[model samples]
Target: MTNDMKLNKLLLTLSVGALSFIQACRSPESDEKLKSTIQAALETTPGIEVNVEEGNVTLDGQIGSDSLKQNIEDKTKMAGGENIKSIHNNIVVNLPEPEDAREKYHEIIGGAVDSTLTRDVNLVLADFPTITAQVKEGIIVATGNLEKSKIDTLKKRLEHIKPKGIDMKGVISR
Candidate 1:
């Protein structure tokens, strides 16, 4: 083929490929598809409701904390992809009534505690890499190796959170 013919053919092929790419990158044509996609993303979480209208997404649910509610909104956005224009996170954080927290003693934990409490305990110990804490029925059990002074500090801090009791028996003081 002539050089001119070859260049024209290349340009035509390039134009077709670019058009195909654009079509694939386009968002879902219907709101229902977008809603279903978001629903699948948030399936693990219960009490959540998803609604979509003209690219606007409304999320309603009851969650334990603000962080969790924000997480749901973010996950919905990721699932909806370009199809979601806006998100209305109307998730209510159902805070429980204040507890008496009259924890007198530490109880032996046979297994993992509630996920939220475990997460909170982990966050509290983020600075102390050597320490790990667990809770069972409001009792906290800490095990790790650290300086004696730091252990004292940790005990005070853990007490601030008011876990029924702090068990550092497994903790080794240096």
Candidate 2:
């Protein structure tokens, strides 16, 4: 080979080797940046934890819902950028089961409904418009838009039932 041809071949080989080295090398600073990026993105959402090392990220802890989990994962992958080689998602879906408020609190408010029914169906319908009462774990929750006068009467009626507490916060007076 001519001198110029050999010099060109040597330069080509060096360039390929440098490219390989650059591709293989991953800096701790980049890992830290990735982690911080994920943290900053997910900081407002509680129970999400991120750990990154050498372009690999591991997500731990819990998320409230499936949609929320997906949202977080999408944001994480986006934030991790092209440097992320793999993600090990170990996120748990932690959600509290909805309480069967009616079943649990039926006995507490059942008598009131029964008493109202016994007096007169029209009375029940007139006195309580779309009224719903449920008791869960000793707490009573009543929902409906009630007049102030009806609210006073309902309170008096519920007083005899003796619940742990009555939550009428959802009830708006008209």
TM-score of each: 0.46, 0.50
Best by TM-score: 2
Worst 10 residues of 2 by lDDT: 96-105
Output the TM-score of candidate 2: 0.50
lDDT of each: 0.73, 0.67
> What is residue 28's positional error in candidate 1, in angstroms?
11
> Which pairs of residues have clashing backbones in candidate 1?
none
Error of 2 at 10 (Å): 3.2
Candidate 2 segments exceeding 4 Å error:
99-174
For candidate 2, write residues 30-60 as lDDT tens digits.
Answer: 8898899989987766667899988899999
Alpha-carbon RMSD to native, per candidate: 9.4, 13.3
